[model samples]
Target: MTDGSIQQTRLPTRTVVLHIGRHKTGSSSIQATLRHNQAQLLQRGVLVPKNLPPNLSGFFSHVFSRAPEALKFNVERGHGRQQAQKHGNRLLERLAHELEAFTGNRIVLSGEEACALHPDEVAQVRDRLGPVLAPAGQQVDFRVLLYTRDPVAYASSAMQQNIKKNVKLLEDHKPVVLRKAPGWYQRTHAAWAGVFGADAVEFRSFETACAAPGGLIGDFLTAAGIPPEGIEPQRANDSIADEIAGFLSSSHVPKLPPDQRGLWSAGFDLSTADQEILFAIRGSKGGLLTASEQAGLWDAVAADMRFIEREFGITYGAAQTAGAVPFGPVFMDDLKAALPRLSPPVRRGLLAYLRDRSAPGDPGQLQPEGI
Candidate 1:
């Protein structure tokens, strides 16, 4: 038998709920809900860090002294790694210290990228956070909250997301495969559990949660241990309009300022007609996935799904019917509207410019000779 005192169990004066997003898992909605209800959560003895940017660095800093290279990839790929890292340590440290100093509240830090980190990186986070609470005479408990969608459904949604983002690389894509298997989830969860312990982790199905008694927002709040009363369902990071995506893809490409250039560049590689066809196929609601060449792409995704389930413990749910969301027509309309405004030569020039810019060049050739 053990003593029942707070000190005996190392009960955390602060509770850190890390919502490592598995991407395309309604992470934005969850983050938005938490942000909107920060005050209410605090009133309930829960401290969701407000100062921290909705990114992973702050959470990662709690696990490691320095940012990992993979984190840099996430940053370079426009995941806000650098910006998040910039204030990660300060934000987490401040939250931890403040919660300890002021109220015996639990600090909940939620971000989806936390789920994508490598296992070793997760371990570093656990160690870093563990010591901070120990020395402060407070217990630190790490809890991971995540949602899994049916593999096919997740893939379908994810593909739409990729198309919206103009992402070109099919090789790095993991939608159909993730739906078919659980490897991605298993790896991500394993990373967190390895560091924080399995008991500290919790998993929920987004599909089920969404269809639960009150819907996704309600389910999320309940899962986070918050009462659902008076909680407004705050939707965050919803998809941009298809016209907006088209405009961004065209006008916003070459002219993006230096700081923002990298983001636009990371979209689809349009060098090949097949790539364009794939993009169109994936982007369309009723787009066929079984064209002669496209079959290979689908096969790849299927293989990936198998790998994901085998590795991550993620399971695919029933397939959801795809709907005509009007993104494609809107994108096309936006493209046409933008095209007539530019002269033929100017259009050709723009295409050439983008082609040249996206093409591989030696590091020494970063700046052209005659500027």
Candidate 2:
């Protein structure tokens, strides 16, 4: 029989707060705040892991996604199966090492990709975590935090977020596949709950979180059992306006002269000045999507919406709040009005793209997807 002292020497329960964002629920902001205040949180026994793969945002997708081979990080570099598995193994090792070294009682792993994981994937991660802790005789308790938005709003925000990264060469002027509905809330969430147990998973309302004390970051930290004091909230919105997103995918890019047209052929990082200038290209203040499109999209997501309401009493605002508005003829007019505010090169490039695109046979014709 083992000595009673061995049992007494076991490590105290370590609580891991897994913030699996359902996207566009201020996940960027929460991550930013958590990362920015890392030192302060560490003092209070809460940890935002400092050592892990560089882009931890994609960590879950790299490891748990059904199609790891197709990831941009993999495909762009021509990395395949072996590289992906190696990366996954490395991440698991890093996590185990970090947990072993941390002085803190609570660790926060914030990544929206976790919300996208399938059931088997969830089980895989859960199983790995336990074994990693087994060797050290450490017990772990998980608190899974998810923020669910109104399905219609999520679809709109998610699509525009996709447009921000699309290079013309990689995709046509449409979302690869429009999410006809919101996330499979019932299926995927239940999967997470099953893996971690229902009490560990707290699917909160995005709308309610926003109205809380320090807003989303506060609500998240509270749910995670971290002290919310002295941690400043931060916001990170990298998305372009829907109109600009629509414009990028419209037939106009195909119309540009070879010199100007090549801009869309590859992806490159924008300097802060250029990025801010790009953000200036805002869509209509009145909002551009038609009522009919909104209605149909709602019809598609209504069942998921009802499931959340019935199960979690989750009310994610209304469908009319947001939806993707494709490029209509009016979008060109909006761009023209904003031209005086644009820098010379951007103005010239857009004008040239427009020149060839406008034809007598197809005046102001646009071909954005999800029309």
What lDDT would each prediction earn against the true structure?
A: 0.54, 0.66
Tens-digit per-residue lDDT, 182-241, candidate 2: 447777678899899988888889878888767888888888887787888777875666
lDDT for each residue of candidate 1 in 1-371, tens digit (9 for 90 to 100): 54666457664455667777667767777777777887887787777666566555335543453453335444565545455465556655765665554473465666666665677767766776666543456656666788876555555456446655555322244434434343565576667778788778777778677778878888877876677888778775444332223323453333334465354344432334323322332223322122332344434356445544564454553333332233344444444444445545444443444334332332222133311
Full-model lDDT, candidate 1: 0.54
TM-scores, each model vs. reference: 0.62, 0.77
The superposed Cα distance between candidate 1 and the true structure at residue 69, in angstroms, equals: 5.4
List candidate 1 segments past 4 Å from native: 1-14, 57-88, 133-135, 166-182, 240-371
Model 2 scores a C-alpha lDDT of: 0.66
Clashes within 3 Å, all models in order? 24, 0
Model 1 TM-score (2 dp): 0.62
User: Candidate 1, residue 85: CA error in Å?
Assistant: 8.0
Q: CA lDDT of 222 in candidate 2?
A: 83
